[model samples]
Target: EKEKKEKKERKEITPEEIMKPYGVSVDNIDDDEVRVLTKENLYDTLLSLAAPVRQLRLDNSEKEDRESGRRVVIGMVGYPNVGKSSTINVLYGSKKVAVAATPGKTKHFQTLFIGEDIFLCDCPGLVFPSFISTKADMICNGLLPIDQMRDHRPPISLVCQRVSRESLEHVYNIAIPKPAPHLPPDTIPSPDDLLNSYARARGHMSVQGRPDESRAARIILKDFVNGKILSVVPPPILMNGLDAHGLQKLTKDFNLIGTKPAPIEDQDKEKKRKNRLLNQQRGQRQYTDEDEMDRMVRLDSVGHHQGGKRGGKNFVQNKNSNKPWLEMKRAQKAQKRAKKKR
Candidate 1:
């Protein structure tokens, strides 16, 4: 089946065959985009990649490595035609039975090997969103515009040229149907024209009676990126992370290694902070003035100064007398009653 598909692609006309490229390279992009590569391939590509992403997440409890204790999951990620599949294939060699480029090439996820120690996961390309900020979801189908790109955006023609490997004729070759009729000489169509023709041929009409080729081109590129239309899956990984200290590098690279792991006093400070927060939460903790405490002390002094005799009488009979007989007797009797009560 793969052989037949490759043969069919070989025979089909693509847009790259017609256009000429102004020398430039789009090789620096590393985003594994595919969903909204364009509106055309959005639905199919999303459907293709999503099933596998979910499956892998559920596959296992990625326990730490026995030797290095690092949880390792390495997947191939890159733009379409960046030799992603080829690289993976080179890694695994011929052991993994199924590897091929589907229509729009790499639409599905395939699990391959890393010699015998690791797992190599192959996924569909991610379609970067265009136009505006897109929700990371399936329904939008990666349908974003060039305006959403960071730094700069190329013209539509430029994007097509790059995507088709600097050949408009190549793209036209793939787009034109087999056994197509001869059109007039000098009626040679441009890349945009060919795209428009294909868009019209496929019936993508707008309310303004235009072909909407821009939409069509975006769709084509997006689909190819996602492997929704056709692409190749590369081989497996040769040297797993287990060999070159990949696991060691991952495990000990955290900010918490070899530094004596912060003192217990730091924890105590954290506890104090948390307690302060709790008190604040209950509206019970705040600064208090010494003036209130001083006032309370003053009140106790004044109470002592006003004698306990209720009538405001002093123990001494006269103002100057040290003591009076009756007063002394009453005080002693009152003290005795207080002791009895205690």
Candidate 2:
């Protein structure tokens, strides 16, 4: 009877009771207030969040401070390499602070004035204690630098488990051997197979003429961080109509509608215009045979008047008629000179 009562109590524990230990009240939560942010729509997301963020700050601020016209200071805080500095840089419309792929780049907290009465404070990234299944998860998620990792197997194994062997082969453009027939059909390829294949393809060989697994691991991790390998976790719930409408507005504003190529008509028109202008310029510069003959006569007269002989092999009578032959002779002479020099 005691065990049954305890089990019943455990099963009856409400969300509010579960969150009480974390100082959160389920009744105060507003599901409609949630905003989904993604890298694809970062600027739009930030713009939408700006008003709410400022209002929240003002609401929480003391009345005296609000009356004093104190600047709204927004603190940017998150795990390492999660784009805290990058966000500030984007908001500031310039590189306000240094940003890098490696974690822990921001060593100190820095403040930047973004607008008339707004300031953004960037804090150094620090990992908070949480219930993590494994250290490999942190490394794969880019919380830790892959280069500094002493053991690459665990993280690479995690990556293999998450990303399929086919995806690995396609992304790296290297063939990965299939698991042995004795293994289960759904078995994933080992980290060694991926590392070895990548290393050989990229010519990453160690001092002992073995595949350089460490170098390959770092390269793979960097690719993962840069999103070369697609890994996206979708939201638990689908977007509501209001959220969908907002997304549609954003898409229209950003011109993110169709992937079809731009109309070739415009390009064709531009190309025709360019060709017409080029033809006009060419016609203006083009010299007729009569013009060329007259110019050559003038040059010959000038040469004779200057007391220079004109019957040498370099000179030709009616040069315009024998222009191709003259050019061939010049080219042959150039080839002879090149051979002698060599």
Candidate 3:
């Protein structure tokens, strides 16, 4: 009876209770041992990792090889084509490291000297286990090459889902099929629709005059890899900090939308200019000798028909030769003749 009563009194712990000890808000976090360093704040990130300031000492037994009586070795590791070598070059103040756009350019590890006692160890770029949701995410982050990908639909679909549809349409100067008010948001255009739109806009057609979706997919993937599509995925932990709308605003603030493509108004103006030029070219086309000869023959035929005795040949008339206007003129002439006869 006592055990039953105790078991009944025990409360069930929810997920919120479990996460309480780790601190629930982003504001609660203060200090960090490691940070994501970018080109914009490379110096700040390096300074954060520096050793604590110490007073100068007169110790004679210190090693002569250790410059400034201090030494620090920093290991820079990331996936291929992530600007690891470029970061090192920036730190060294010169092109001490070879940077290439291709993956796996640095086959071996390299040690770069940044300061008298500071050294940067550039490890070979290697893929590690990560919480990647799909192949599209990898391609978008430049971890996978677009050409090597067999099916580009999944990545394209993911891009359509995460990226702002308006921004994409504006950037590509194409329309994105919108969902109906009664239907769910899933009614938006699929990967195939987007690919087709791109193919049509760029005139990438197959032998059958159909949009070449495969080629269009390749171009879209290339844009994503080149940062023309600026969508980024935040870590799962930071996700709780904002709602869906807030997250979208944050993405906008980051300028993740690609601005390479021209605006819709500019595209319209350019298209109109091209059409005007085409019309001018068509009007300026000189008549060939055959065309001139055909014109002369037509004029001679009209002149001969004016007074020639045509039986059945004159009966056959063109349907669109101002028939309505000719009938009206004929009625007026008949009215004038009847008045004269009266």
- Top lDDT: which candidate number? 2
Candidate 3 per-residue C-alpha lDDT over 97-212 given as tens digits, one digit per residue, 9 for 90 to 100: 88887667788988877656567898878776467777777776777767788988888887776666655675677755566789876444689878876776776766545678
Q: Report the poorest 10 consecutive residues by lDDT, candidate 2.
A: 255-264
Candidate 2: Cα lDDT at 300 = 46
Error of 1 at 196 (Å): 10
Q: Which candidate leads in TM-score? A: 3
Off by over 4 Å in 2: 1-69, 232-342
**Once model 1 is optimally superposed onto the true structure by TM-score, how far is the C-alpha of residue 8 displaced, in angstroms?**
38
On lDDT, the stronger of 1 and 3 is 3
lDDT of 2 by residue, 159-208 (tens): 77666555566566666766688986546789898898787666676644
Better structure of 2 and 3 per lDDT: 2
lDDT values of the candidates?
Answer: 0.41, 0.65, 0.65
Give, for candidate 1, the lowest lDDT window spanning 10 residues: 15-24
